[model samples]
Target: MKKEEVPQDESCFSDTEMKEVIYAVDKDGKYDKALSSGWETKTIVLDKSLEHIEERKAQAIANIKNGIQSPIAYFMEEHRMDIPTLASYVGIWQWRVKRHLKAKPFQRLSAKTLQRYAEVFEISVSELKHPKF
Candidate 1:
């Protein structure tokens, strides 16, 4: 496509300095890099993905409040991590991470264990034990 014809559709990046690099044919018929704020379809897809993540986080918070899950569950959702991923990050077994997702088991966790999770979440141990929702 011609450089001047590159899609510059406004999107979520409109308020920021970020731009997507797109290759287009220049006036001399040579490929050149063009900057785009964003395109409509990509914007819609990103918005939907973010919405889904928010929904998941909300459910995790509700589970924590209802005692169906632990504060670890909420932090896991907030960090966009699954049990295996979180376990890998914290240097624990996947099953242990799964166990910790339950309120009872999480309550029995040692401070050092909780500290590992907090480090992975980049928060404090207190925050890990008592998430701020």
Candidate 2:
């Protein structure tokens, strides 16, 4: 978007947080590097992306509470992961990871398997089994 169209609001990135990029050549032919030149729209896009993530997080929490899924599903959403992604991280098959997303299979997981998931999620095995959220 044009610099004139960028919204100046609380959600916009502050001066300190804005990233700089080269957008044009200066009169002397050096690159013109400034955050204000080309990256304003990126901030707006990032804010919207974060909103989507929050929405997914809320849905995951609701799924956990309703017992339609397990805490693994919730933490997967929290970590921005899918079954395949989590499977790769935990060194398991995608189908096994999908099984772990169910309460019954999750409860049946051995401590060693739970430890792999916990290590991938950067949490303790107990937290993986019984997330506070």
- How does each model score on TM-score? 0.87, 0.76
Residue 133 Cα positional deviation in candidate 2, in Å, after optimal superposition: 1.8
Candidate 2 residue 112 C-alpha distance from true site, Å: 1.1
lDDT of 2 by residue, 1-133 (tens): 3333334444344545764443555556555543442344675798788788889888878888888778988899889887888898989999988988887788788999999989999999989878997
Best by TM-score: 1
- Model 1: how far residue 21 lies from native, Å: 1.5
Total clashing pairs for each candidate: 0, 0
Model 1 residue 63 distance off true place after TM-score fit, in angstroms: 0.8
Off by over 4 Å in 1: 27-29
Global CA lDDT computed for model 2: 0.76
